[model samples]
Target: LEFLQKPWHNGRLLRSKGYFWLASRHLEIGLLAQSGKQFQWDYVGRWWNFIEPSQWPRDEYRLQGIMAKWDSVVGDCRQELVFIGQGLDTRVLQRELDHCLLSAQEIAAGPLAWQALPAATAFDTEALSARPTPPMAVQPT
Candidate 1:
């Protein structure tokens, strides 16, 4: 998984004046392994999305928040995400993501080669379920 923030021209931070233009200027990339009843594939292509936090309603649940609590194992295991935004250039995004996929040559190199690719930081899923719960205090009936 990868999270990317669109950098402003000259690398300036988005300012108040650019709020509307930059509100949804973020990208999420995911990679998922495919499985069938009796077989599993190495990896499958997934989609990307542009996210706009500003447009979400106050009470609406956002993937960012939900993702924060994701169990790394399962969360890190799938390549799936929703791009949230407005007026996004789907073509540009698609082209960029396509560049990240493994080429036929890379795929032929096998699992060891695939594992050598650079990857972003991922959540620690094993720790998710391993956390101990707080004990409940006794209460009057």
Candidate 2:
């Protein structure tokens, strides 16, 4: 809907640079909270870099104001915002929107790790075999 209201850039409406930057910050924080995976995927380090030590309270205000409250979980909406900030293309934009939306919902509900994705044993042989792997080392031909 936000995209529809304005020219589509990257699932974003192409606002000013500052707006996009702010949106990126918001989006990043939201993604971190939702996926239980921070941008750097740190154990103890800060996941959302935008919220500085002094900015924590400000974040709380923005979170409430921007996300529409715990019911909305604004923190989970950062990926789309960042994608827009970085200016992804149109199809990319829609795809991003779809993905970020799901991430947001997952975050809103609970942590992503707690939710089960199928384990290797849960799939058929081929499906299990599809697991990503490091490429075989090739020497001289």
Candidate 3:
């Protein structure tokens, strides 16, 4: 929030939006959308890390596919946001967001300590469960 709320490039920000993982909620993905001075975050869903290998879709590529994007320690948790505006200083934006990331000591404390921090967004499993999971892409036999 501090990043978006602060005046940048003389208040030239037009839009910014993307998905990111918060240290506070390692399992859940956060979606950030900002236009001018307003922005809101929504829960996108859980990373494949939370989904047990046994529960993964039968599609053969499922495991191989996600592996390409996964990290040894954090699985697929990452910051992937884009900023757009006139006269935007990308270096400052990157530095600011990078500073917000968890440190080694913080990461070592693990999920329990991380979860103790306040969640950036709220999501109800009941509501999410009511929505159907999209069918997997068909693989050639």
Candidate RMSDs in order: 17.9, 15.2, 5.9
lDDT of 1: 0.31
Please count the clashing residue pairs in each candidate, in the order shown: 7, 4, 0
Give the candidate order by descending TM-score: 3, 1, 2
**Candidate 1 regions off by >4 Å?**
1-78, 120-141
Candidate 1, residue 55: Cα displacement in angstroms equals 42
Give the TM-score of each candidate.
0.33, 0.24, 0.70
Top TM-score model: 3
Report the C-alpha displacement of residue 88, candidate 2, in angstroms: 6.8
Error of 2 at 132 (Å): 24
Per-residue lDDT of candidate 1, residues 44-117 (tens digit) = 11111222335433553544543454464433222233333444556665665566456789757755555455
User: lDDT by residue for model 2 over 68-123, one digit each (tens)?
Assistant: 42223333223223332444466776664463233445445543432342321232
Which stretches in model 3 have alpha-carbon errors above 4 Å?
9-11, 60-65, 118-141
**For each candidate, what is the lDDT?**
0.31, 0.31, 0.65
